[model samples]
Target: MNLAIALTAARYGAATANYTEVQRLLKGPDTGRVCGVRCRDVLTGKEFDVRAKCVINATGPFTDSVRKMDDQEVPNICQPSAGVHIVMPGYYSPDNMGLLDPATSDGRVIFFLPWEKMTIAGTTDSPTDVTSHPIPTEEDINFILSEVRNYLGPDVEVRRGDVLAAWSGIRPLVTNPDSKDTQSLSRNHVVTISDSGLVTIAGGKWTTYRAMARDTIDAAVREHNLQAGSCRTMGLQLEGAQDWSPTLYIRLVQDYGLESEVAQHLASTYGDKAFEVAKIAQVTGKRWPIVGKRLVSEFPYIEAEVVYGVREYARTAVDVISRRTRLAFLNVQAADEALPRIVDIMGKELSWCEQKKKEELETAKTFLYYEMGYKVKTDQLTDRSEISLVPSDIERYKKRFRMFDKDKKGFITILDVQRVLQSVSVQMDENTLHEILNEVDLNKNGQVELNEFLQLMSAIQKGRVSGSRLAVLMKRAEENLRRQAIPVDRSGGGL
Candidate 1:
């Protein structure tokens, strides 16, 4: 219904039908009641007038602002509450299902919705000023982190780095005049008509939006004395509902080497429209394996998705990441890395200038960094990986690591270290390298920190002892590990 409504509004736009407006409702001359509405388009600075028999103020948190046009004295019964949602990678939850966290530390109900190959959790309610974009605070994030860890196993820790995107929305809830707690407020839709015949609708969830909209349209028709018939949405068939099945997915994996997870993501998100994405992929020869080995975890997204989002749904890099593909919500660094290419693609698609492209990239960065609580883009901070090293230890290792980590990304792949080590008189097998990394990498995130590098170097130095070397090394390493107060499991550590 939301998609249909948005498309319908686009079809009915006043301009060239190509431009969409974020409109502002203005107060016009009134005869003790609203006679007409003056609107200004926020995008193109265009102004227009709509003299309607009735007007519907369906704006969610801004409903009270709209009601002010009719009469500011109308008691603002709609209280806006901020709710935060955190998005992690798809591995956190089942691809086909979601989890309901019945309670949080704050006694708020949380939901883990597996949306578009990302796990969206939280919905902590806190009273906030009606701002343009409400942001989740550090307390909010830590609270969610603690709650998520409570449900996870002992070895699995949902750290701040795991969060890809975080967003907060203002829930327009109907409040009691004397109630102190807005969280206890009713979520039911509230509709009202002022003496000016302006109809205002507010406070409802998505499940009941159809009913809310039906009642709203009905109210508009009755108040305006229109000839429109009763709502036929009861029998409405949603778009892209044709011939969707698991067979299609199986065929995709069989024919295209797509991951079952990727297939599932597309099928659920686009329904029959999965064909369109696949068609693009096939034509461009850009098909990717569902578990993108390149990405470590299967990134069930393809280059073709960039094409689809531009032509079909998105206007900017932010839209592509946040809404169209859900990549930013799945991986923060990946999204940041992809942003420039996405902007370039979108710029060409939309015929954007250099300034517009820069603006789009900045917009995406702002949302990703601040709203989603992803990585701090400008600041160098610790706690990105599961491993920890004090500043002095980090600096010590970083200097030594720069010799091995050619790229200076603080991650030394086998090839990278081999390139440096071969320059010297050092050679090692892949298994040996893996064994060393596995031994020192405490968190098992496939990245070796400075401490790990020191440990590996020390192990290599201790290997010079001849006959008892194997037995002596093991015993000494174990004793050293005990002295250092470190624990080692199979492959050192497992996530």
Candidate 2:
């Protein structure tokens, strides 16, 4: 996405500049028009103002905030919808192509797409009240899992263990007076001319961005009536869009013309500027990728393009990924893998330091997690103690205790203990009974109880327990065991 933006910016001959954030608006006489915008460079603490006859607000989801700059209330016009995706092993599905299920358990469509070697499926739509960072909750995960199981089979279970990555994206929908549901709102865009004459454009999809931009510029041109050059964007090819096929070079007249070569190059990169890229490629001994090469030069070519983007277009890594490249919709792994390299290349070309690079990486990751609804797992150790019980071991003990305490009682009787030990292939011998009685059977009423059984289990599991703690816990387990006690062989018996 950065490459595409840089290439386009270079073609337009626009110089890209960074802004810290809008500090204030420079208003015109009578405060009727926004004559300029003032911002400070977050790093340098330098302030600058951009004077313009007309201003366009392409701030997206934050459109309302920008509107407030003009002292106008636009109401809450942005509605954020969250979508999630789950990654599983390659063999989970065949046919490499993606699958789209219209009927999910939660009433949202499920996309089971082929992403590289792995299969990616997901998406649950939930309303988000907060405009800030949004995250996918446990409920969202369960919702997706239930849908997957329904379509596949009961045997196909998506446990917390199987998840490799999860993510969410916010689709900014226009709020309408007739409908309260965000999903029901139209995907089309709106260009609003505020009373203050601040033009704001909002709500469009990735594929229609060019059309959106063109329309926005046209609206600004008409409103401001400012002197400007013709709208050359229609026929103007972007930077990398040109090229000529090798076969066409064979003809003598065609060779002299060299028209086809230029046409092919433009078709490849600039779409209109194929001849320009071809001319540069020819002189510099650099070749753009043909249809099949998948081109190694493309990366460096893109690096050059990033130079163009940073210099000509107002682009950040976030804008490059979300708007320019449309990579946010691609698989999470591909996006994650490409992000660091992109940041490194951008930083070097843009003269950003390690701190700047770190900031960009963090910002991009946050955008992915909050704005996009993707789950990002960190390597931080929550359970740092090496002496803690193993999760598997804990689970096993829990299962055993639950099985012995039948009738939902909390205690285990002697009979219950004997039956359980027998199932484990252990003999219920006199020595074993004596040991069990000595260790458990608190209150000394000659009856084993749930509290006593639980105390024994806890001591064994921990390898040690305080005598006082045991006495208190055993009392409860004993009562529970008594209520759940079942008849079993009283005489010492073998399993």
What is the C-alpha lDDT profile of model 1 across 181-244, one tens digit per residue? 6445688886777777778888898888779878888887888688888765564545555577
Off by over 4 Å in 1: 1-5, 8-36, 89-104, 112-118, 176-184, 242-264, 278-297, 377-495
Query: Which whole-number lDDT from 0 to 100 does residue 438 have in model 2?
Result: 61
Best by lDDT: 1
Which pairs, if any, clash in model 1? 166-372, 259-290, 291-298, 292-298
TM-score to native of every candidate shown = 0.71, 0.54
Could you give the C-alpha RMSD of every candidate to the true structure, in order shown? 8.4, 15.1
